[model samples]
Target: MKLWGGLSVLGLVYAALAFGIDQTFKWWMLHVFDIEARQPVALLPVFDLVLAWNKGVSYGWLSGDASQDLLIAMSLAIAAGLWIWLAKATHPMTAAAIGLIIGGALGNALDRAVYGAVADFFSFHIGSFSWYIFNLADVAIVAGVGLLVYESFTEGRAR
Candidate 1:
């Protein structure tokens, strides 16, 4: 298949995963357990499944007082730009990376649109400090970034 075709397929797949799986999980978390309920399902000693909401960016920055309207607007803009960029991507790996990033952005953007906040349910803790709660969308974004970085380094080596 052509690069454009592959990109389209991958992008749609990513978007579907983000929309279907993430939203379903969010709905369950919100409707079944409620946002404020905290029950630790231990994945490991340092990790737990605990429901939390983030009204702002990563690590809950600007969470308390940030304007929801501004955040949603920015997210929409970013997702659009990213989608266009992903569509234009010529390399399979680049398209995949951008698709993942776009998926993540869309997932969080949907949350903000629907809930006025991002639903973050996974939490990690160690000894004295607890990591900020986050969701699968955040993981996808981080993994996308990691793949992009790896691509950059490996691209240079392959040339």
Candidate 2:
């Protein structure tokens, strides 16, 4: 019982930290840096900071002129589902992964609610090849998914 409670607390903390960091960075980008009024800022040979507003799912899928509301609703629903999973997670890694995913989803959902889109600022490119623009929340979500995949494979092998 105590262990579960500790896990729950840990998950909540992870979620809050991830969400807060992502939001803070976004606020700094928009307000402090005033990225909206400037061109892309190159940080390295393969990385740059460029503001982009994503109104749809990953890679701008399902994004149209009239789909903002639908996207927000869908994101909220997914976050809710992940929250439930987090509550019931028995493994610490699973809880942490779920927390990361939930935090990221909620952060983006909040952006959709307030700004009508998610603010993406980090761009990675190699000469002519460019990756999708993303933010801290996207990084957390991807890392969490990678952890989950690793756990799935390792658990199966152990059993």
Candidate 3:
């Protein structure tokens, strides 16, 4: 079998889809919906639609007037590494997961390049307990990580 087992196309497709969906949502939110003006709109008892311009890393870490260019460069670097892994991926699940990550990373990097910060919207909370605001790209990245962890546990095990 080839290094990727001729399955790289699956990953490329997933990456494209994830990136498209993420950008579409962000464009609608920023342009049509203007989510910043309509802040804290409750979608559910435990969830809300809000605008959060993250100038930092995950959970608002490393925020300190860092240049957007720097952050975007970092994202691209990480995505390049993931792309290498995807090129060698043999399993469909692994390929998809890596694609999701790369797509999400590129989406966020684009946001930084255009908006000067990552656009976050979803908010989950319960009473006084609140989670960090995030966007669809964040969702894709998290889902990708979950898939990787699950694949790690399941793959190469005797069936």
Candidate 4:
């Protein structure tokens, strides 16, 4: 397939959408909603909105003051590599998946740059079990990765 054409444009649109939505959510939650003041608000029986600052990667791993700049740079670098990959993507799903990943990565990186940490708000729990607090960017990244994995498995077979 040709490189950097219609599919790539579609991917850029998806990326812009993801990034815009992620930033908008973060802005609303932090400013308009004042999530910290009215925090831990239950949205469902098993889910809620809460404010949490993650200085590191997923699940707050590798957290510390020094790692902040490192993480931001790493995220941008990965997003840039994915953008190149998106330019060559032949399938719509692949383009979208890469776009989502790129957008999410950049979104989280921007959070780190502006807030000194990633603003995670969504929380889920059941009984004694609890999941890590995360943001929309995390959701998009996970969904994109899931789509990519699914595409890889199904690629060998017919669509």
Distance from true position, residue 90, model 3, in Å? 0.6
Q: Residues 1-159, candidate 1, lDDT per residue (tens digit)?
A: 223444777776766676567778888877886655657667899998877668889776766535777887887788777777776776777777777777788888888878778988888899989988888888877878898899999999999
Whole-model lDDT, candidate 1? 0.77
TM-score of every model versus the real structure: 0.86, 0.92, 0.93, 0.95
Off by over 4 Å in 3: 1-5
Stronger candidate by lDDT (2 vs 3): 3
> Candidates 1 and 3: which is better by TM-score?
3
Residue runs of model 2 more than 4 Å from their true location after superposition: 1-6
Candidate 3: C-alpha lDDT: 0.88
Reference-based lDDT, each prediction: 0.77, 0.86, 0.88, 0.90
Model 2 per-residue lDDT at 26 = 96
Looking at candidate 1, the ten consecutive residues that score lowest on lDDT are 1-10
Top model number, lDDT? 4
Clashing pairs in 1: none
- Candidate 1: which stretches are off by over 4 Å? 1-6, 33-38, 64-66
lDDT per residue (tens digit) for residues 17-124 in model 4: 889999999999999999999988999999999999999897778899899999998998898788878888889999899888888999999998998999999899
lDDT for residue 111 in candidate 4, whole number 0-100: 92
